[model samples]
Target: MTPHELYADLTRSGLNLIGQALSIFDADLRLAVANRQYQAMFDLPAELTHPGTRFEDTIRFLVMRGEYGPQDDPEAAVAFRVEQARTFQPHYFERERANGCCIAVEGAPLAQGGWITVYTDITDIKRQESLLRARSEELSGQVLDHAERLAAANRELAATNAALQEAQRILTRTEARTRQVTEMVPAHIAHVDGEYRYTFSNRRLPSIFPGAAGNVIGMTVEQALGAPTFDAIRPWLECALSGEAQVFEITHPTSGRRIRIALTPDSASHGVYILSTDVSAEVQAREALSHASKRSLAAQLTSGMAHDFGNLLTIILGLQGRLAALDLPGHAAQDVQATLAAARRGATLLDRLARISGPREMALQPVDLARLLRDVATLARPSLAEGTVLDLAIDLPDGQVLLDAGALQDSLLNLILNANAAIAGPGVIALEARFSGEWIELTVTDTGPGFTPEALARAAEPFFTTKKGQGSGLGLSMVYDQTKLVGGTMRLDNTPRGGRVRLRLPLRPIARQMILLVEDDDSVRMQVRGQLTDLGHAVLEAGSLAEACAMTDLPGLTMMLSDIQLGDGLGVDLDASLPMVLMTSLPPGDPLRARAQGPVLTKPFTQARLAAALAEAGKRT
Candidate 1:
């Protein structure tokens, strides 16, 4: 063909063969020729299209990098395309559209001039390529990991094979030795399948059960024992199959012999090994020990219950005395009062029994030892004989001691009554408390006959009492328990005047603050006011919040003491200047209780406690 004709033919063929868009540039990177596909692919603006348009200018107009940005490396892309054209190798470039479809450009140099580039819509191919690449990367990582693991497994297998060979040699010798030893031992030695089928048994099996060893191997528990012993061993056999190792003592009724059996399952070997030991002597000893423990526990429970009952009786009798004094003219009043009193007394007795037999689980709270002592003395005063006078002289530091209030009260009441009973003349039962270093020391002094050496030594032993006919002797034991529960120590010593039980409870230094006492009950208010006043504080009394709020003039009030439900109603206005402490008998978690701002001291608290809580609040403030 002629040169001009060849050029024309080549241009036509190149434009057609390029597939979509064809573009060529000179070494200087100027636009030479662009096919119809090229114009359409770029959405070439008619305004910038002319014969001599610069390639770089065209790219700036045609290309947007990702979503809405200019191409970052346009110059470098041009340079790379130029290099590919000069090198005579086909060059490929991927371009993406706004719709996420990708166009692949396969650019090649035209033999006549410039470059020929084909545009292929390769969005699907690109997506498949991405998935394939991700899968390949994952598979490659897995293959590398698998190869390393396989290598490690080979090494482990080799080592295991060596160990197995050595173990096999040792096992052969052990089996021979085991068979010899088995025949010599008095007890039968045997192996069974996971299904409990007998795999092996020693000669002793025949002696234990005549002809039992014969045909026992490869036979089930039922087959070997003929359904009798199998019934006894069935549960254990099932447990073994479930992969549990069982060791138990069974009594053979027919043999009348106690035997200890151990069965261990081996799933890999599909068998369970059985070991039987004669334990008739051990069984008898254990039975005897169990019986003795039960007797001891029963005695302990009885004494504890009796002592608790005594405390409850004292409370009931006190209430009953007060009830009897009241004028009740009608039959209904008398009968109802009598019935109620009887029921209360019965409940008290039952409570005592429950406390003695039940576990001594106490919910511990921070308590003042001095306050607890005084309250106990006052409660027991009503129960004391006419001549007995209870004196509580407590001088403890304002410190918190962990304790259970009910149990402590019971212990104190028991001691006080015991003191009243002991004294023939005018009796003085003094509950004295004081802080000594890290402990609060409590001494119960009685003007009675002092404890003997034996009595002092056995004071805390349950059921060991001097008042044999009258006492259960668990009073001091309960006291001992209380002392231990609070991580404290107790001592029974002869006082200069009479008998004294000294208890020292561990002290935990807590924040001290002033307290506000709010109560409408006159006796309760007086008792609490006196208690707080004696604790050395500026005691502010408020029967209601109006009275509580009236204390705004008291410049140094640290806490506002208020009742949860006052004589009028609940106190809604909280004096923010002072922390509020509620003194109420209402159960905790009551909605009214939530309205209070400070810690609550349940009603019927002693003066020392009111003082200590106020002091704690004062310190925190």
Candidate 2:
């Protein structure tokens, strides 16, 4: 037999072995399960004893057989019993059958609906009580009667107690299952009373906000979420308590994550329900889309103007060239040459404007920081005046970071050239690059007269240059545009040393390691294996945590890429010494996913995303 069939047979055999008769009906009042004793006790036919038999049919059969001592209206009696069974509650009772046999019945409701009933034959016990009452001469008649009644009452109480215990078991299991489901959700689900004290929580606060208390129950909102976060949402909490629902977003001060909170008034009580989720990724995507839309609009508006202006510049350049070629006076020739230079500069400015307004995609690739910095220094050194010193310093982890190399190079070169121009004579220009948390910070500082108050304020604005007629005014603006395109930020500041331009970009390093790929699904394992191979990494595959653990002794194993939920064990329980990157299909708020020690990649990720995850894992090592 199959395992399921064997299990069912075993269960039936065990139930049949019980001394008491047992029957269970589902919420629909249809028979779900019954023991052999139950059928034998009622002398039920095959049809009434089988699963899915209606409760009304069983009650009608018993009533027609005079089981309830000859009811005047059998149909009405069956209807009454069936209706009682439909609205079943925990109960206990005893009744004498037509055969003069006494049986005690106990029934308890199930948490998921329906009820289980147990029947115990009490004929012998009843007879013993009657015999003691009638034959005992030492005890008075009234005393004997009272003792018999007390015995019967005690038996009834015992049955009721059994039903109550069964109900408690069901309730406990139901409560446990409810908690498990709530804890699996990726956000914080909580309820707070009118006084702003937390009454319930799913223990997901820590996952939604870094360093938040895991259990907020019995704590005030300000105490659990800290003063700053509570103050930020205090007004909304007040509104919710006053029966007004609220939904809003806030930036978390500690983690810098965007949090979306929804507060709803609890109609059943004087409280408010709260749901908090981390929406940083969503906010980032929305901002990127908004920026793209604005750039597209700018391109559309500037295309015609740029074309017309290009034609005018061309005409001016052609006429000026012809005038310079003629036998004109020296002063007139110089003026013609000047006109040609002005037309060419205008053409250059138009090209820069087109670049700024046009659509452009970032070309991200792994770039060696040390080498890139050296190249930038080399390019900028030639443009420096005599005796000017260009200093370069780089302090970063030992890995190639993913970035748009051309864009970064152009930005840095422009900053260096601007610094060079700012210094009147021999001076020092310092370019420094370092790792700052999850960003690469590059600063270009020059020992020159600091920017004027007005220049510092509008330096990054397009066509807002301080270089009179010698500059096009688009250098810093182009740098700012490129920085934003890559989700980076640029700041223009004046330090005690000189003028400083600092750029901060998200750091994504490229990690190529001897990886152990552990996944339970064969197809998924193969697909991920292919991705890893395409990224130029040698991969070893395992179908489960056990298999993966067995291969830990393999040589040259630099890191492990594993699924969070494996067959034998969790990926988080794998070798702690080895660098690991976990993959999962679980929601971000799930406790298992949130508690993972290493970086996690959600399912259906591309090869590029895998590479980035591997890099993050490599850094942890």
Candidate 3:
């Protein structure tokens, strides 16, 4: 037999041997289970004793038979009993039957919406009590009455005790379930006493603060959170304890995760309930969006001015070039050449402004850091003087990191030039690369006079320079701007030997793979194909997304470049197996282009720009 059947059989046998009649009724007042003694004691028929028999039917039979003594109305007596059962109160009572017998009845409600009743015959005990009262002359009438009342009170106490035990069992189960739910939640939930000690914890301290101890039930707030984080939230904790709830975000020390914590006061107990959740990704996305917004405003302000400035510079450059080519005096020709040079420089400045201030997105791609460091060193060596020594240290691991290669290269070249200028052609310049935390650290150190305090403070500001005649004052600023644009950081300091500038960008792995080029226009397709080939990628051609989908199974085609408004079909519907970079001549404000994630290359992009765009598009998957 099943275990449940065995248990039921055992329960029935145990109840039968107890010498007391027992019955259980469900929430609907229908009999659920009954012992053999129960049917025997009540002299009930099979129909009334069986499970699912209505309690009212049983009561009506006994009432009509005068089992509860002669009643003015049988219906009234049965109705009263049925209504009392509906309330399901735990009770104990004794009743004298018509057959000169007495029985004790006790009933208690079940936790799961039911009631159980027990009946015990007490006819012999009642008879002995009556006989004792009659035979003993010393027993007063008042003492006899108190003795009977005491017995009734004892039975009531027994019934109350049974009810109390059941309630306790239910409460224990509820508390266990509640604790399990709290422990499973991703966020931390805790309570701190007035003395700042943890009174309750869900054991999620390690998740909120990566290096924190998990078993911190009784630890002081400072001890659990460590000194740095504790101090940061101490004032807020105090405010919460003062009955004002508080919520704030903080960055974890070791993991660099952003945690948003809410502190609610337990007004009655004078403690604080804490809820904390990680919000690192949210904060990063928000900062990136804010940076993009600022760039948009900058672009708006500069586009018109830069456009007019460009026309003027073009006119001056054209006039100077024509004059220089004509037959003229030596001094006049020299003047013409000088004017042309200045006009060209102005045009260069305008282009730089557009890059630094305009909405130029970071074209990120997987770049091999070790190789990038070597290339930087090679490009920088020609700028160094004969007396100066250049040192290149490649300490990076064998992996690729995502970054805007062109922008980063330009920043490093600026650093090299700045370092060369600082050392005055006769000192050592160290170019170092390595990994630190989640960033790839690149440090350029030169043997030269360090920056003055004023220069250091304003070095990253636009148009701030100490070199009066030669410098445009935008190099360091441009480097700082580029770093921020890519969600990276830049710092400048002085070592004992020289000035040091360090850039730390996010580390992302890059893998070289073949790219499929999809364009309907032959010229545009050819041009893009050549650009991909220039970037050392094996390229495949496709005129439509249908062709692209057919090529999805090609082993080497790991990435795709497609035009959104294609001749055969929309590029967005192409098989998503390959990471995609979409090309469009649409304006930046166009919803279709603006909503595009990852990388997008506009019309008329250079080979270097196409390389960067492809790298970014490769990350979409």
Alpha carbon lDDT of residue 111, candidate 3?
74
CA lDDT, every model vs. true structure: 0.66, 0.86, 0.83
How far residue 435's Cα lies from its native spot in candidate 2, in Å, is: 4.5
Q: Write the per-residue lDDT of candidate 1 for residues 1-621, one digit (tens) a residue.
A: 899999977886778566566666654556666676677766777544455676666655544433224456866665554454556444554567776778765655443445545566667766765576567765676675576456446644654554456457767888899889987887877888766777788756644543344557677767766676778888987898788999987655334356788888878897777888776557656644553354368557567666667676677767766766788668856875786677575665455445544555554455776777767766788888787888878776676655566777877787778778778668788887776654666678899999989998777765578886666666776677666655555667786899988776655454433556677776777776665554444566777766766665576556677767776666546656666566678888887777766666776665445544554454455
Per-residue lDDT for 1-621 in model 2, tens only? 999999999999999999999999999999999999999998899888899999888998899999998788888899999888888777888899999999998888887689999999999998998898778988999898798788878977887787778778878888899899999999999999998999999999988888788778899988888999999999999999888999999877555568999999997889999999999779767755665565566577779698799889989998998898899999998899988988898898888879978767676667888899999898889889998899988887787877888999999999999998998789999999998766788999999998889988778766678888888777987887788877786777798978999888888867667999999999999999998887678999999888999988799999999999998889988887898899999988999997778889999887667777787788887
Best by TM-score: 2
Better of 1 and 2 by lDDT: 2
Taking the candidates one at a time, how many backbone clashes does each contain? 18, 1, 1
RMSD of each: 27.1, 9.7, 9.6
- Model 3 weakest 10-residue run by lDDT: 287-296
Instruction: List candidate 1 segments past 4 Å from native.
Output: 1-296, 299-350, 512-621
Question: How do the predictions measure up, each by TM-score?
Answer: 0.30, 0.67, 0.59
Ranking by TM-score: 2, 3, 1
Best by lDDT: 2
